[model samples]
Target: MALTKLVQLENFRKRSGSETSVAKVLSYSYASPLLSSPLLSSPQVFNCTQLDDLLEVYYLSPLYALEFCLGFPGNLLVVIGYVVCLQEWRSINIYLFNLAVSDLLFLCTLPRLSWLYANGQKETSPYACIIRRIISYFLHVNLYSSILFMVWVSVDRFLLIRHPTRNHFLLRPKVAMAVAGLSWLAINIQVAPLIVLMFQDMQKAINSSRCTDFASLSGDTNSFGYSMGLTLTGYVLPFLGLCLSSYNIARLLKVQDAALQRRTTSYKRPLRVVTAAAAMFLVLYSPYHVMRNVRIASRQEWSGMELCTRMYIEGLYILTRPIAFLHSVINPVFYFLMGDQFRELLFAKFRQLLRKTGRQRGAT
Candidate 1:
């Protein structure tokens, strides 16, 4: 067996052995297996790091599986409903359609993640390594793209409601398309450093036994600054956008439509989704954001307690992945259940399916 083969069997295939034992097994291809000493027969410990094992069993594996379970049906309905609305696309629905697509793309990657996490991310195949990295790289871009598009949608809603006089300038579908395309381009630029860092320093990452982006960098100012800067941008920019959009939306809601102000001082659903979304975003993301900055800031003066704090924060961070993704699963509730148009679409689809089945039965 090849070294890579041993790596797979020991990890994924769950065949037991130490490195020496596996090396001996491979040595048969090179020399005589029967000429082995006691070292040759010793069992091989897997290439999977201890952290990988713990994360796989305790968090990463379960979260990957759970996210897929929750995400597939959630995003699928949103995508289908979103697609049906394409003929009459507003800027809001356009962004929504894109959000659905991005979420779907992420869902497509979940199975590979589940498999890798189940096997403790040993990365025995170089192709597997490359594929995983590429998926992650695109996911990195999509993260920013999705957030910006979402914020833009909220901002659009804000402008149309709050400043209707000035907002009509951007209400065109052509303009929305251009903005979305440009947003994606910007995200691609932002994510360039990740690709370079991954490809250039992957060997060092593997050697570090930390299977994450931060582990690959050298102990230099440039590397430190680059890593921290990317992480901060990933968090801070989207957060600011969300904050501004939310504030504007709140302002719009408060204005009471000028006409409705005479009748009532309330909203239909009381802004529950808005509050919940904002709260969950902070809860799920803060630990990861905090840890990323702290990791960079204290690179030189590493504290044992700080390291432990970061590890605990990472635990929080891993837990947060599914929670953050749960946003996709939850978003359609507001889009479909809340919207009159989408509800009508669902009913029409149901009626159409029932009619199709009846027609088939009549033919029989």
Candidate 2:
């Protein structure tokens, strides 16, 4: 009887080990069902089965660092230049100020995310999960809020040019401030659900061995309807509004130029503004949104795509993600280049610095 009991205990241990090994294998195999053939199915063989190569770590970490370096100071300058130096606040400046604030908020998250990528996301505390979720939420908030503010800026420009005297109430600085506040509130509310979803996912992954690995697990839906909804509402509609506003502004400028051919040069600045806004939407944001939708679609179980196709989609996502962040860096540059007052103030400040330096040299 003693021998039989010992044999039973040994058999139980073997079964438990096998089950744990299979569970581990299944976790990876589920990421790409097509690669789950019996020949390469064992957990030992697929121990390093990640959805994509670790190459993204090398690619994304430096890009995040670069973005932080450029975006932080550039955005801060915009905020300071508008708030302190410019005494007369135009309606458009209000939108620009809020946009700068949104960009700065997003920039604040980059160092943490960069460190995670640089060292590998090995911080597995529950607090790490909460922090990651907050970062993700604000990232989206800043993105959508920036886009909406740009839309407001374009429309304000249109109103200023197209019906300068008729819509005084619409172009008031107070109205712009109200719109900016509403945009911030709306975007935060929109992204609040994602925070809850991420927390729930973290609960399920509480026992995950590696914190970095746990954080990598996305709670994003693979549903077609959800992807389409995001694309249409978040991207397509705003893009359409921007285009319409830009087109009308261009048309009005052309009409004005034709009416007063000698005043053609006056229209150039406004035209440049429209062109810059359109180019920003086309170059920086469009690809990111399209690639994001494509990546989501590729993850669907019914897609029937091979592993290579999925890999490509994942790579494209990693590549475009940083490109989207470039918008924050570019925005301040755009404001300085396009705003006459901003440029004037920047030059004045530069001359003041030069004078101050010369005085110190004379004293020395």
Candidate 3:
């Protein structure tokens, strides 16, 4: 039965084109129960160019554009509010402000990505690939930077709750600024290797005409190991830190509730903030990381229908990319929620401007 299918596929390939190779080895389980576990000596290689291009055009392009449009206003407002309205900066404010800046930078890269995805087939210029590589570098920079900043924000909030006196050295703005600078340096260090890998991928004839996301780049064996290492240090550690921070805050809240024999709304706010940050991390980051690892693994040796399944996983990975970035649009909410003084000051500034405008109109 396998021989019959093999002959048929060979004939089809010959008729299609000699240059195109679909699958070197095919595995099928449809014949009978015994054929389900049939062993294959070699791995199957299926070309996913068409699928990649299709998803790039239809799936990623529109999503990136929409994310940029929706995320820009909120992130810009947060940046402006932090710079103009907020008179004093706290540790959380510094962290959240950095996060807002990171989101804005990330969002700024999306339009170029969208255009690349939309017109990827036509983009053959060397400069375009260079721009894509640079954009990809900054995208990861902002992504992991935002993650680290949020982790700091959560930990800072927890410490503030643990010590209401606010005497924690790490809670100082200068200390926080230094931490933010180190966070940027750390994320850049983590993402620096990607640009080299992406350059090597561009040398491949398969990737000659296009640039792909790091997970989607083939022809490089080192990318898989690098990706695993990146996921570990860039995401896993920060996620764990966030979880620990949230857990400690919750425990403190519980102890306070029990000791006071009453549930005070004051403690609940920090508890809610940390818990929400943790929830956001889980909801947004987890799937992207899981699917990214899976996507990389899918490029490994596999045969038959498993290759087809990997194709579907690739599509799912593509979908997760934009969803993970939804954090940019959502971070502004945190900006408003985490910084009471910022929010209040922002509203007051707006009100003052409105009153001035009203008085000027009356004078006219």
Best by TM-score: 3
CA lDDT for candidate 3: 0.77
Task: Give the per-residue lDDT digits (tens) of candidate 2, residues 30-119.
Answer: 556554554444432223323333544787788888999999999998888787678788788888888899999999999988888777
Off by over 4 Å in 1: 1-52, 163-167, 205-224, 257-272, 295-317, 337-340
lDDT of 2 at 288: 80
lDDT values of the candidates?
A: 0.58, 0.68, 0.77
- Of candidate 1, the 10-residue stretch with the lowest lDDT total is 11-20
Q: Write one digit per residue (lDDT tens) for candidate 3, span 71-183.
A: 99999988998899877788889899889988999899999888888996345777877888888888888878887998998889888887888898998889999999889
Ranking by lDDT: 3, 2, 1
**Model 1 over residues 15-47: C-alpha lDDT tens digits?**
111122444434542354532333433222222
Q: Is candidate 2 or candidate 3 better by lDDT?
A: 3
TM-score of every model?
Answer: 0.74, 0.80, 0.84
Error of 1 at 178 (Å): 1.2
Give the Å shift of residue 166 in candidate 2.
8.5
Error of 3 at 226 (Å): 1.1
Colliding residue pairs in candidate 2: 121-212
